[model samples]
Target: MRNETYMWKILAKTEPEKTLYEHTLDVLTVLKEMMKIFPDVPKLINEPNFWDYVFYALFLHDFGKSAKGFQESLRLGKRWGYRHEIISAGFVACLEYESEIKKLIALGIASHHKEIDELKSKYSTHRKNSPGYERYTKALREIEENFGELVEMMKLIPDLSEEFIGKKLTNFKIPNSLDELLDVFSFAVKSYEDSKSSGIDRVVWLKHVFMRGFVLGCDYLASSGNLEIPLLKNEISEIIRFEKFTDVQLKMQSEDMKNKDIILVAPTGYGKTEASLFWVEKNQNDRRTKRVFYILPYTASINDMFKRFVRYFGEDLVGMKHHRAGYFIYQSFRDREYTPDEAKKFANAFVDLSKKIYKQFKIITHFQLLREIFGLPGFEMGISEMAGGIVILDEVHSYDARVIGLLIEALKILKYEFGARISVMSATFPKFLCEVFKRELEIETFITAEEEVLRKISRHKINLINDSILNGVDRIKKFLEDGKRVLVVCNTVKKAQEIYNVLKEFARGESKLIHSRFALIDRERIEKSLKNESVQILVGTQAIEVSLDIDFDVLFTDVAPIDRLVQRFGRVNRRGRLNYADVFIFTGYLDDDLKIYDKELLDRTISELLKVQRINEVDILNLIESVYADGFTQKQSKIFNETRESFLRLRKEIYPMLSNKIADEDLHRLIGSIEIVPSCYENDYLKMRESGNYFEVVKFFMSLAYPQFFKLHRNGQIYQHSHTLFCLAGYDKELGLLVDEFETNILE
Candidate 1:
């Protein structure tokens, strides 16, 4: 009897010898890890009816992999792997559970192999005589027959109300948008139908996809040496282990919570993302509303959040929003359920809002919000409704003054009008904002432990490198030799390229140059590289500062706004490690026009960091305030000062009735006056973007630029641009020609 049970013994062992059980556990591990990145997934699944369904779906996604047909018992059958999911479904149906559970299991197994829409499900029933029908009928019949005995072998389901089930589905389906749920379901059905002739039945639906993805993700994670899934009772140990951060990091986290909206004003290399999440985790998990919106300054940062979110939340839950993050977003709003006319009316708004993201507890990126705000025609109504959410603006200090003013006011509006919980994170927040938050929210979060902050700072070193490009490269070369990683940042793509080219020639060890111009795939490649190395050399645009959290030893940066300079330094020696390298800042002369155009900010920034090579948050912010003491931010300075003053006046004028009692038209009219160009577009720009005859995309953009979104070549238009994400174009006049124009978004 023992010999006969050897297979069971094999399965019982911790080491499963690369069998289906091992693979299943691997899937579970990956999903568990994915949950860390997307910490609020349980909330997403808290829905009444589907939560249990999703739970089991996640549990039994691949229970049937051990079935015979799926094993391909012959050598020749290896390549022609049968639709194991169908076989898997049959096995699941054989389990003694509720019909829904069996169906859910079947769906999870089938959909993972081929998503629903890919199966052409909607058309399956009548689209053909014997085609789609054969697989559907056969698979359904087989599952029913096989699991029939299990259905007789019973277990009672908890009695749930119809209303509760509907409510849960509404919450589950709503955030992902009602339309998305349908599409994903239909996609599953279609994919199943499409594969009919190939010998499969029904494809999976949304619940299954989420479940299987979770299961598969969990399975993948179990294999990782650094990660382990804590048992149910061991969650406390996991939290404690995660919470075992530096005291300084914890203190900064506390300040952010106590203060309404405060910046970290530290260097970049610190664990800010984790720091912020730690803050959120500490606060509360009412689990009713989504709590975080990590508005990364860069899409690359968003991608970092994407990985991090998956690490925290669970990949199945967190959705990355960017113009180009299609894997998790709608492919084309103009297809099937939506029309061109509908696309024009609800086109961009629907596209932006219809993502399956609302179901998620965490969101990443401010650029997506910017795009959704720029709704096209009737699309405006829906997009405007997308507020009342949490917003975390990381690297806020990296923004220019005008942009900063706009972001601050926007947050206040989102807070008052939309019930948003806004958190602006930076190592160099201005006192202006601290007061702004106090005035806006009644409560502000500031971490004021001077000795603690100082302790964190003492572990850091600063160096200024304002020499030519060659000098910066040489300095970086020397830094790299100390076995410390070095990051070189430039103001322009060309400058970054030049430094990268120079570094390529001299650096013997690992070195890489990354910028927005090289295509998005290229940028992601470089970022992935940075994550692995210790003492490597990296030169890029401001992309490295936000989400690219490599434990760098030193940093070198070009001249930038004072707030931005603080953020740049924030990137160096930030993790409270004395072994960290110093930051060498390099400043060059700005043109007279640039200085004049941004006179107050230019003066403030320039005066703040005189040497560039050696400065910290204190030095930079002090210089900024001192430079502004001459009344740069005062009412007397007309253009910008007046703009800042006007922004405040507008907020105060509209602040009182924030209880959803105000009218939408009034809100739009109020927002219309203090204009910041939206980062997203409602135009056919995306469809036009791929028409890629080069000039075709550009011409298409210009032709449609007149009314809906912006007039062609408008200077103030804040485009939601990306390196591999979004881009904006504008006209130039130096040689009477237009050049590639840009706005600050993510790098990748």
Candidate 2:
């Protein structure tokens, strides 16, 4: 017989060798913490004994690791053909749980490490003479001996039976044969998958998936005991307190938004954020809402919103999540006084905890929400968490047709399927898009800025210039010479850079250039500087479109889509204090401008702007409607339909497969953006890596559109260093990433 002490050392490691008992206890503690954070998890599943089932699963998840053969494999660092999850599933099958509960627990245990296909493949074949069979036989015998010991250990915990188990374990039996065990496991897998396919009792399906995700979360926290999972404090005080609401915000508050979905259309700086927050606050008492997800389209906007929300809701209640969330959390840690090592640890812990237990008020990109709808791995937990939450879709107009289609599907699932409350807001929500929503989701609450307020916010004097961007350079210089804060917007990065180069020489005040190609850290720094600087000549691309709150006295922009043009105009005279600000709309195209932007849309935008010498907020909706009256073109409609069809296929067919057929990288590629660290920063990157502050330095990495990255790669202007792409092209500390003049294929 194996000694208990020997069994305890079976899964030993030098870093931290937690005994099986200690690990189990740690997992139990984590489960309790998770329960506290999501107090209504049990209610979400509508299972009174949900916690009991979870406790049993957690206790037995690692039971198979106790097998003597498995222990020897771990000790010798040998490849074990069979995983412990299969053995644990066998043990779970012997439990006295009813058929349905046992099936759920068994499937969860078996799938803890491997998905369904791998599990089936491993167990489907049996070779009695194989080493795998010998190990399996030994593991079974060991489980028989240790089963009673586990029961005895459980009794030692205070009120274990009364509080969790609900009864004392006296009798249990292992499957009489290996075939029987395999058969039982196969049955559970089939039954679970079948139920999921049938869509019978979605609550039951959610419960099973939630249990799997919860168990995995607990197992991870227990194994890597480096972090404490922080629970979100969801008191009413956690709602951001506003001193006063603007006129629009006041209207939002006065309206009855309880238990209703809303679509609010307002101009920039019209208190849209406050209005959404107020609506969430008014419905704060609703039991259906588990948390709040304030979704934005861009990382910059998400970061800005995260900080703005942190001020209203304390830092502890708000979290910023994105591809570079680790970097953000690291920066937050660096903001305080901490040792280098301490900061690294805290940053890692904060990120881990946030992912495990999302904060009450989360500022995240829409991709995160779409991930749940796609039913990827660990998304079950996300779906459950967001099922009854409030989702605020900010800047809904910024996404392309493909993304807009996915967003609409995700909203449908969130609102109609999961009982979530949704509020979609944009500075320029077009009538065509609104009609689509009304047709699809039947959204009734449509709020827009009052005509008077629109008139007040309509502070731009529009001027159409049927000339090249070069012609606008002199106008930009004139604005800068007059001491008027000048903002020049280009349709592409190359144009922006060219225009910035011209304005830099002639500017009387500080000149700055910004675009999507700059590192996130640099872009953020520039944005911060722009906010503080009163008079400056700022040049940028479409990066200036949404959620950036910088205001200027005059604007020079290339004519594009009406909605995009409106977004650019919003940055000028943003406070509505001036009688009117000048906005010069250059109508001629630059290099690849026609390819980048639809020519017909540009023509329509120019035509519409020519009609309105003084453009206001009310003019925006009508202009957008006119531009998008026919909806998506043939190619765009095809892309949108394909994207939506793919989503449905994944959710219905592919997701049910035992294996995850869709890769996250594939999805990211579809998103068509990649983050790269410039070669010039390689030394700093290496130094940061060595100093254990890599996460802090990650913010400086620039994200490039796929076409741009490919162009550089084709010219041998980009290099790969340590999983990051480094561009050999020139980059300026102040001007940001620049396009070399020699490039022939400039992403037309």
Candidate 3:
């Protein structure tokens, strides 16, 4: 059996090592998630040559962890650290190579975590002669001294050797010679010329540093046995069967969402994930040219979706991004060339895995989305990796304006530039979103099965009772009296708190309140609270809207935007139940701020329903679509632009204060400049951010359960309150970031 543990012998206490470990785990976790998206990879590993090099690169990428200064940094956990990575590079320096293969591997390993300079700077030689010539020499020496005697011990498969020797590979150097450069280009980054890039060719794609990365990744995941992989396989079929989608759905409604960009606004509980699967299945093999980017609004939702995919596809096909817990990606193990100093060659495994999926097919959430839309310094390689995939935005309607703007731009790139497809699905979508997609996209379509679709699929009644706050309280009371599990949903956080407090007086024991205010653990505990049969009433804001697999009977919601109202309705009578309870939308009383948002949504809903002048057309989905068709026009384009611009302006307005310790007096000037009066990071919020990309960072914030508020910015940065941004500057928290407690500027 291949050894799974990847422990650097002389390293335990050091800051750099810890950071490296974190980085290693983050990379591996993304790879392991391959199972969630493409579970058949392990089976591919059964091939001897392919598996060996992949494992070799993964295992030794961080061999520099054994150095003393690296140990001291971890022990002290300080800012300044020694160059133990160089010490690890020394292992590769001792190697004896036919030319410089061993040294190239070492240079790849040494430069994994940190940015490397030119060979000329380090070796005092001609940088023009070799891009990574300095470190490559060191790597070659390490192979001879540190791992020379162990050559016999390392797995030496013939096919693997042939594959490597046949291809002349170099590191970080684009040869000046046109012929050599073209050869380099062909070895890497070529598209679709060979979609069947499994086995030997796959290993070649990730041989050096990328291989070292896969082992480190697998090891980190192995350390945390408690890590949970979402089980979406079983849930998908159940979701489809329970909702009873028509046979015609197997062949996606072409006109509704043909070969065009689209945003789907069907009610919640409408078999969306499965619909994606149907699309995938129909286009399978043919659409292997692209993968699927599953974009979710929350980590909890992502987890749920991950599990759904795992259950459906199994471990080999998926890749996960569990941003809240800890960062890790998984890949299979194998053995090969070992040089102590020649580590750090595995940093590109995520990029490599993404390439595999793009060549094959995959299902990922924000991992690729954030990268695809936004550029990263080292991993520009991922852009091509995301080549063969459709970008699916689930719960997009739940996004704020900034997120909406980001999606519009990103989808535009995927659609027009990349020739990729985009499908935005949510139970609720407003007129603004419809206008955003219909007008902005090159070729667009809209598929809203709304209430009519929901009703047709599985019978349910939408009993819109009295529109009053007292009615909301009354509805909860009645549901409890009826001995049914009730789900109460409100629009804003403040309103949710007030109604919950009042309902507490009328309700018995075992009622639960959940919202954006609580920490992630608290929210999870609250979610767990629902599992008990004794729990009767569940009340919250939009936080409990969808992505959760909770079952409830009756639903009471305050007057909300039409799409949100539909989403809340989805929470009830989801799985075929006759005698459905009433769905009351209380619309009378509203605060000034909410009045503008709420009335606009409600006015559109009511106006549309009145046009037909019949109860039959009151189906919320129809009401929502009518609002879009009637309300959206060239005139409405200005609102989309204004909303997007203002959100970005607000982000820029408040971002500066986050980094800077500003004078209190300037706070007013800062706030005044904000177009939307951007909200500040939570007052009391600090938690260890498990390292991951922007999505995980955001999810970790939501997981903090501290009333954490984050905005998925149009720049692909998800800003939230965390100990990480302050220290790492990942979310741009640095000097002069904050004007005061709540003011700063975003450099658009």
Best by TM-score: 2
> lDDT ranking from best to worst?
2, 3, 1
Best lDDT goes to which candidate?
2
TM-score of candidate 3 against the unseen true structure: 0.56
Give a tens-digit lDDT track for model 2, residues 1-748.
Answer: 1134533443523256666676776777777666655555666667877766777777778767766666666677775556777677765655676788887777777777667667666564245656555655655666554555554554444444333344444334544544445433445766666665576566666666677777777777667773355433454434545686567677667647766788998877767888887778666644323578899988778877877887776766677678888777677676787766787897787677567554677888888887767666667656766756788998987988888888888888777656678888888776777877766676898877778867655688888889988776666767677788888998888778777887788877778888888877788788778866654888999988876778898889888898888889888888877899998988887558976776777777777777878866767777888878887666678988898888887666434225666666656666777778766677777778777676867865888888888888898887776766777767777777765734223221
Across residues 93-180, which tens digit of lDDT does each residue of candidate 1 receive?
Answer: 3334555555555555555545434433432434434555454444333333223222221111121112112221111111111111
* Model 3 ranges with Cα > 4 A deviation: 1-113, 116-248, 253-267, 286-290, 325-368, 415-419, 428-435, 444-479, 482-484, 592-599, 606-618, 629-748
lDDT of 3 by residue, 154-196 (tens): 2322323223223222222212221221111112112211232
> Ten consecutive residues with minimal summed lDDT in candidate 2?
1-10
Off by over 4 Å in 1: 1-275, 278-291, 327-358, 374-388, 440-443, 459-486, 532-536, 551-556, 570-582, 590-748
- For model 2, the stretches where C-alpha displacement exceeds 4 angstroms are 1-52, 69-82, 96-100, 114-131, 153-208, 220-239, 285-289, 656-658, 690-692, 718-721, 741-748
Against the reference, the lDDT scores of all candidates come to 0.44, 0.72, 0.45
Rank order by TM-score, top first?
A: 2, 3, 1
User: For model 3, what is the error of residue 377's alpha carbon versus the real structure, in angstroms, after optimal superposition?
Assistant: 5.2
Better model by TM-score: candidate 1 vs candidate 2: 2
